[model samples]
Target: MKKFIIGLFALVGFSAQAAIINISTDQASYNVGDTITANVWIDIVELQGSNLAQPFIGGFVMSLMADATSLSYNDGSIMFGDKLGAGALSALLPVGFGVYSIQSAAFTPSVFTLQAGLTSFELFSLEFTALSSVSDALFGLTASVSEFGSFVGTPVSTASTEFSVEATSVPAPSTGVLALLACFGMMVSRVKARR
Candidate 1:
């Protein structure tokens, strides 16, 4: 019975170290032509009172999907976070359509490892321009970490968020402005007739 209890505790400790992916935007809503900044984060903190050491990640591949019609991805706007450490190589792979793949890895396995800690670290960020107003502009993400400390790979849960875009309103012309425009039109017509 004691052996079974120990095995159960080990299973629970292993599950607690799984990474979590998070997606967030700078604002709750946006307007047409406005820029939106989306940030991706990974949380690998171990559960409190767990004896297992936090696992470090050597690299990660993340794919982001956005509504192409409503939000246009900004070229050259992919930025990696410092947690990846120096000498980390990254690339922005345009998969065509509306999916973007971001891959980053340490040049040398021993050069750096996303250190284990009690907090989350920023994985990367992307920028997009609001093309048109939409009730819900959806963004989706899927990611996995490779070369985890002594482990082959770890899969992170998929995450998504919705953004709203509202159209910018143009003020209507006032009555006085409309009357002035009519007077100007009449004077121009009169001059043209004289000529």
Candidate 2:
């Protein structure tokens, strides 16, 4: 039993060393409101499956702020495709190590508009909080951008393309203004008659 325990400890240390997290963005600097897409992934190629479902990977969505007063919340939703059958399963990259398919898609140009002048980094939370489950511990995360009117594109190795959303807050001329002007003209005529 003592020998078995020692061997297990060594194995665990080796496995932990094998697991690493890598994050990359297409663009580094983003405007306060610019919509940017980022990709996250891992390096392992094979994972053994368990008979049960497991959470192997996930990510934190955040945006960098320009200033305290210049930051605002950008609202968006996350959707995961290619749902796997729940069970003890091993995950193999559709491609190979350091390569992966799109597990989730993010709508870009940001479906949500940010507050004007609020330049800060904000993380959009995931709708599906669970990560992909594989037989082993090698896990990775990635993001696909879906701008305001578009959908996600094909998967790639790196995340890039950082930008900002411009705030549009102009009020158009209202019918109320025209009515006020007419009323003022009528008052002026009445005053002129009295004089």
Candidate 3:
């Protein structure tokens, strides 16, 4: 029993060191009320030479978290294409106050990529509109491999990262005095044209 437990620990440690889940935003910065898309991906190919070759070998499920105070989840933004065909299982919900969760999973024996160079699996694209009252806000969304994180029923490796989301105040229009200018222009045009 002691040897078995030690082996299990070793296995988990090795797998944990294999792959990682990364996050990225469509834009580096956004203005207040501006909608933004966040992407979660399995960045295995990036770790190609560092001991672990192919981080994600098969289909897997990922659960992500966001800060509801700074952002609100948009409906129907998740897109996984053919590999991910979960009817209602893939969804975004408020699992807690001020904290929201997104679930994404895919299963396909024909769509496995565990070889060679940097391969990226786009798990999902989530859209969120900034909702903070402050002039600016900067935060990050995090992700983790769910218990269902597996490649064809076998446990895979994963790591998580905090991607930044910055929101700034939208610039005001510069044409506030356009009406007055237009009236003056009309008068000047009439005067010039009449003369």
Ranking by TM-score: 1, 3, 2
lDDT of 3 by residue, 1-195 (tens): 999999999999887644556666777666667786776666655434466545433344444555667777777766653434333245566667555566555454333432234465666666778775433443344554432235243333433333344455467656858878898999999999988
lDDT of 1 at 44: 63
Task: Compute each candidate's TM-score over C-alphas.
Answer: 0.73, 0.23, 0.54
Error of 2 at 137 (Å): 33
Q: Tell me how candidate 2 scores on lDDT.
A: 0.33
Candidate 2, 1-195: lDDT as tens digits: 999999999989878632222343444433334433443333322111242322222222212212113222222432222211122122212343233333332323221332122222222222111122212212234433222233333232323222233343457779999899999999999999999
Tens digit of per-residue lDDT, candidate 1, span 1-195? 999999999999978644378899999899999999999887766222254666556778888899999899999998888666677888889897889988888655542444645367788898999999998998899888775333344566788989899997889999999999999999999999999
RMSD of 2: 20.6
Candidate lDDT scores, in order, read: 0.80, 0.33, 0.56
Off by over 4 Å in 2: 1-76, 86-156, 172-195
Q: Who is ahead in TM-score, 1 or 2?
A: 1
In model 2, the Cα lDDT at residue 182 comes to: 96
Cα deviation of 106 in candidate 3 (Å)? 3.4
Where does the lowest 10-residue lDDT sum fall in candidate 2? 125-134
Candidate 3 lDDT (Cα, 0 to 1): 0.56
Q: How badly does each model clash, as a count of residue pairs?
A: 0, 41, 1
